[model samples]
Target chain A: GGIITQTPKFLIGQEGQKLTLKCQQNFNHDTMYWYRQDSGKGLRLIYYSITENDLQKGDLSEGYDASREKKSSFSLTVTSAQKNEMAVFLCASSIGLANSDYTFGSGTRLLVI
Target chain B: LAKTTQPPSMEAYEGQEVNVSCSHTNIATSEYIYWYRQVPHQGPQFIIQGYKDYVVNEVASLFISADRKLSTLSLPWVSLRDAAVYYCIVTDRTGGLSGKLTFGEGTQVTVIS
Candidate 1:
């Protein structure tokens, strides 16, 4: 069984600071995605990578940048953290098929002070 | 991407059956319905996906209507650990990053002892 590992399970950043979240998947999937979930709300897609070095912006891509450094690694960067901004960032991967199932990481909880 | 609607919350007791319904009035013929659940402080986990008719897996059973406008996820013998938010999403045949899966506020299911 493969696992999606997210680094720094908890993050605290100052207002206007830049933050980066990293994800690693052993599934060797061809597609990776980053999603943000606010407290008491559903998740919103931030960005996704279809292959290495390929990036696609989702509905919530503003203020965020993504990097598909390799096939198994995808990173998300917050350009400028807002004060009191708190959310959980989730990483997921899939085989890039028409019926491939998605695997998700535990998540990175971010809190901006 | 087809919009989905689910209940805000539902309550159930241990060993009881829990059925959550989702409505997608404008679902396309090529679209598929998917279910996912999220526990506290964790990322969403995929449960099941189906194009039409009924589909079952060890974790849950999905029943889709003839018109594909409605689908239900049935969880048998609920337990406390099953308490979480359940999401229903509809996406096209092109899965992965190209599918553009959108997650709306899902149903919060509380399984009590």
Candidate 2:
């Protein structure tokens, strides 16, 4: 079994600051996803990539940018941090787009002051 | 993507069985029901998925009726570690390369000692 690793378990940034979260997967999956989770809310998809160098936006992708640098790595950047924003960013990967299961990383908790 | 609804929260005692139900009245034929769990400060973890009938895995069991309007996730014996937010998502298998997953509010299950 392979694992998905996310760097920087916790992040504290100032308002309007830029922060980046990195994810690496060893499953060699073709699809990678980035999601944000707020307190008392479910995960919301921000961006996803079907293949390397491909990007697709989701409902809440306005403030985030994603990059699929390689088959094994996907990164998300918070364009500008908002004050009083606290959320957990999660990275997931799936083998294929059709009815396949996804494996998720532990997550990176971000607190914007 | 079909919209899903689930209970806001639930409480169960240890060693008891917990069943969380999700409703998707407008689910499409090409869509599938997926269940995931998220512990505090962690990313969501895939539990199970099914189109119809019953599907069971080592971690959880997903039961879908013939009508496919609803699905249930059954936890055999509840434990403290099982306390978390459970989300039900529906995704269209035929959707283009980026198969976006929509997450519902999710049901928070608290296991009492």
Candidate 3:
């Protein structure tokens, strides 16, 4: 019965600019994840955190940084925005380490001009 | 991580039954088949998950054969709102501690009037 909330539904940034997306979950899950989805493509993992102050990189984590400031919040930063880049960033959380079901946020649509 | 294959797209009429299949030939004993649905401009939502046999919830039913090489997500009485991209994911048991969930090019289900 908890919800995952992502701030700034839409973001428009210039090339080389830095942008940040934030996520909060009330489920008290131990695992939090960040994923990026491009047009006509499936999602790719960006970064994730298993606990507060813990970080883990994923396949597409080169251009991003993540922070788990607290148990209820996780944030992602686009180090440097690329021109013509447009994608949706999603945040999700799960309860345990094995066979956990994930709950996701609505997503933040980013458009880099 | 086990690789998964799913249909690119499917079309169904309202009130019809729709079945989307996913093939994971290398699925291991510890791996689980998970189904998620993503509406346009939103994050994916968990539909169902199963290791083998059949599992059903209020949203959808997951059917896994004895061999566990393939799984099917059945949506009964499809409605307009059911039009969305459905993703089948195989979780790596060892990677959950890092909060990673690999996603494939999900099957897009379009409900026609």
Give each candidate's interface RMSD in Å.
2.3, 2.0, 2.4
Full ranking by lDDT: 1, 3, 2
User: Tens digits of per-residue lDDT for model 2 on A1-113?
Assistant: 89999998999999999899999999989999998988777778898888899998887999888999899999999999999999999899988766447888999999999
Number of backbone collisions per candidate, in order?
Answer: 0, 0, 0
Q: Is 1 or 3 the stronger prediction by TM-score?
A: 1
Candidate 2 global Cα RMSD: 1.7
Given candidate 3, what's the lDDT at residue A83? 98
Kindly report the TM-score of the first chain in candidate 3. Answer: 0.97
lDDT of 3 by residue, B1-76 (tens): 5488999999999999999999998887878888998998888988998889999999899999899988999999
Question: By summed lDDT, which 10 consecutive residues of candidate 1 chain B come out lowest?
Answer: B93-102
Q: What is the DockQ of candidate 2?
A: 0.63
Task: Evaluate model 3: give its TM-score.
Answer: 0.95
lDDT of 3 by residue, A1-113 (tens): 89999988999999999899999999999888899999989998898888899898888999998999999999999999999999999999988555458899999999999
Please give the lDDT score at residue B28 for candidate 3.
79
lDDT of 2 by residue, B1-113 (tens): 53888999999999999999999898888888889888886778888888899999998899997899989999989999999999998878775633567677799999999
What pairs collide in candidate 3? none
What is the Å distance of residue A2 in model 3 from its true position? 1.4
